[model samples]
Target: MNTENRGAAQPPEPARGAGPGPAGAAPLVDPLAAVRAERDPAVDVYLTGTVFLDIIFTGLDSAPVRGTESWARGMGSSPGGVANMATALARLGLRTSLAAAFGDDHYGEYCWDALAQGEGIDLTPSRTVPGWHSPVTVSMAYEGERTMVSHGHEPPPGTAPPTPRCPPRTRAAVAALTPGEPAAWIAQAARLGTRIFADTGWDDTGRWDLAALPDLRYCEAFLPNAEEAMRYTGTDCPRAAAHALAERVPMAVVTLGADGAYAVDGGTGEAAEVPAIEVAALDPTGAGDVFVAGFVTGTLAGWPLADRLAFAGLTAALSVQEFGGSLSAPGWTEIAAWWRHVQRYDDQNPAALRRYAFLDGLLPGAGARSWPLRRAVPTIGFGRGT
Candidate 1:
């Protein structure tokens, strides 16, 4: 593929004085500009799922004890769940649209504004139900892992999940496949020619049956972690599981947490693997979602299979170094900065750096944002008077 004009162009570098400041100041450089130039103006990616108000507690040396009260050194608040992926795609300039239920409470209002206005995601298909309370998740990050406690009420009787009867016509959509329940919109969107990329949560029922995931037939790609892939395919190796899964889907991507990711193109009988970048992770929340967003961006831009895997791993690597899930996702500026920063170290491997050289033509100039962009603050509300 000719990558020169694939539309991954980024914004011009900032001026000398324009160092990284606030998060919202920079305009997002669309990675899909080139592709969209020749295509219709339909939404780039559409998704539907539950949204949660996430309160993250970080800077912990170990997991909280069973009885003692633990005080975390740092904390942040953001919209999570499907909102993480939605924000990630929108920040990458994918023209993302989301359809999900929201409570009419303060948390719902904040999440709605954050995604719709802050991240430039389309929420026209999303609705807020009266008297319904938004779901909430409290995450505590320690030792590169996290423990979460979530709470929410089932919507009042007769209230359905916010899936539209007729989903929008988009280039692609992300689906979370449940074992027993099938999402009708997945098949609906596929019939309309929308490429589907799906990922599944842990099956609590312990029946990792591939037949249970009926929506796989419509998915263009299925992304599952190493454990999930192995369980579902009944294979010991994740790579073998990817091959087994490719028999049902056009492509299969299996993420190996620390080892990086592997992908197989069933259509071409080709495969690619990329090693994960080492970073001091503060929170792992939403890292998987960010990885999927990156892969979708690269795939939609017609990049090579290897380049797509590298980009996906790179984005997820960057996301873990931050505080919150949705807001922690890096933009073009951050990707550009990381590329430039790594080149300055003498110990860096040339071959490793070369893997990400595709970013050379797509990143911002010398004025790219500084490494470690500003993160979300702990509080969600502000004082009436400054």
Candidate 2:
């Protein structure tokens, strides 16, 4: 997006004359300093919506036919949806908790274990609903895109129990508002002064309900991808669509897949856009969710909006290079490690370094370069060098 900055060995500052952009922050000199946050129970982020056992199939040859069979070279089963966002938040070192109903079935146990133990996410407020089968999503990834089919059963009214109480101190939540799903809880959370970061799922019926606009007033932030924003605002332009949606909420962030992202901060009456980090995407399944995770992390840290968007873009870019949905999210370890790896290369090769130039200003110092050398080198003796 900003090639000059991308290849200049330092990330660019928010351009001054950029049309209708948010106020600028100096180019992030040390990203860690720009985003210094802590684990505060009173201001932590809460993730909701039931977990799904994402059975991801990758390296597919072609789309499966109606009466034909297909095969994928790789497959991985991991947490999806809420877990996707939750894991990404935890990986970003955020104080995160999840509140949702889960099935007592095998899939439920798998997801619970993955989120609670594997990702170190707080699940104390989440419960398992008996007899309700766990949600399962079968994702087929090919050519940098994913096709997902999910199955779940929603208990009828009076039968379905309420979501377990979220952490008493939660300050924010990530949830979707569909037709039949609860909207009252959003108001309840709002009453508690929780900053709700809301997003909507795809509307298959093509009826982008205008009534839902009122529901968003309860949320502090509304994040939707370009297509979703366009569909809701009835405007194909991402910028106009973002400003249009900004009218209904405090902040409207429209995530443009490759074109990066656009946002309007109603609080400051400022709108800014940032470009996406270029990467060879392997599986883009949960990139959007990860982007939100980074954005929320930046918001909680009080970072500049431009920095938030850039960090989010980087997070999503790293995610696409890996396969599974939630499992693919990069932790701080990866970020720091890559920052060091990129520094070894010369700035003279700007085109080659452009991809990593942003890290120069963000990561603190040249992180530990390599592991300590061991006296005894273990070699299987496959080659003469051993």
Candidate 3:
């Protein structure tokens, strides 16, 4: 439980052999272990990308046809994309920062206020672009999958967002790995000693650009979903694609929707895989982003590959079971609650729950009474101006 070594991303050590675990099992470490784990993190993670005010419509059985209107059983809006990831990270008690542009409009103000007040996410580097409308995404959740349509206008003259600077204590970053983002941005971040975790979009052209590979080498991890991974590697198998992509970076993660996820670590030549948690998925939106957030958190926490993958999958599962995209990512309180419930109910799957055994050490005695459950989605709060 001694975490004096800041630079070591070592695997989690064996159980301390003491009073009880974080979730009420046998003793693992001292009661202050969670506090110690949270201490002195310069900046846990920095995220950069388009932050959107997502308008999500869920509980629809199918998409509306061109000539007809549709009815949704549920609807709500929260942050999406980078905003979603940042909110997820912050909810995990990580000191999270976001560098993105916002418009000088109501949507923009709403997003800024929500992220700053609701999530306690850092926005010092985030700017307001006047005379521009904040990006808005319309997400339709149906049949366990979500379709998103986003709209954003070019910012007014000279309203471009500033270049991102990696803070001295910033340990990790999440950024888009696409042609729109310059390689130098990542290079500069790397020079500052920040680990970059990159993600890319699906290739519509079907020609996975080999030209982009060299530029992505600066990243520590490249995460792409199963279809994208297969398209880029020319392999139908996700595991094969992950291994192939690992050749380009230190870590390659291929996310398979229901099958779970697969990872290959280049430094250790270690391969690990975790199955998706079995649960009724209400909305699949933001599940991938939540998984990435979990992966980054686990990596920053120095968890091993297997534990990281399992934790990532668990977070994703928790996200899909709820309504909104970013709003659905569970925090430590939810994890602790689930753990206690499983123990109380004597869940059938002992081995499966053990994958989350990592949660025990996260909170020493699991005194979640002090920690409030943080929800990301909201319609109105006490702060609405009269």
Q: Which candidate is the best by TM-score?
A: 1
Candidate 2 per-residue lDDT, tens place, 269-350, comes to 7987777767777678788888998888777667778767877887888788776668787655456665565556676356
Q: Residue 210's C-alpha lDDT in candidate 1? A: 86
lDDT of 3 by residue, 1-386 (tens): 11111121121222221111122232332222333445444566777788888888888889877899899988777777688888777666566777777877778777777676556667766777766788898989998777889898766655655664554357777877774336556777787778889888866565687465555867899899998888888898999999998888899999998899999998889999899878777778788888998898788767889999998888788778776766777665566666666665564588877777877767555444322233434442346595
Ranked by TM-score from best down, the candidates are 1, 3, 2
Q: Clashes in model 2: which pairs? A: none
Clashes of 2: 0
Q: Is candidate 1 or candidate 3 better by lDDT?
A: 1
Please write out the lDDT profile of model 1 over residues 1-386, one tens digit for every residue: 11011121122222111112233455546566566654554678888888999999999889999889988999999899999998888767677778777787889888877776566677777777777889999999998899999999876765534466447778899999999898888888899888999999999999999899999999999999999999999999999999999888999999999999999998998999999999989899999999999999899888999999999999999989887889888777778778888998999999998999998867654345566666546356675796
Clashing pairs counted in every model: 0, 0, 3
**Winner by lDDT:** 1
lDDT, residue 301, model 2: 66
The TM-scores of all predictions, comma-separated, are: 0.91, 0.78, 0.84
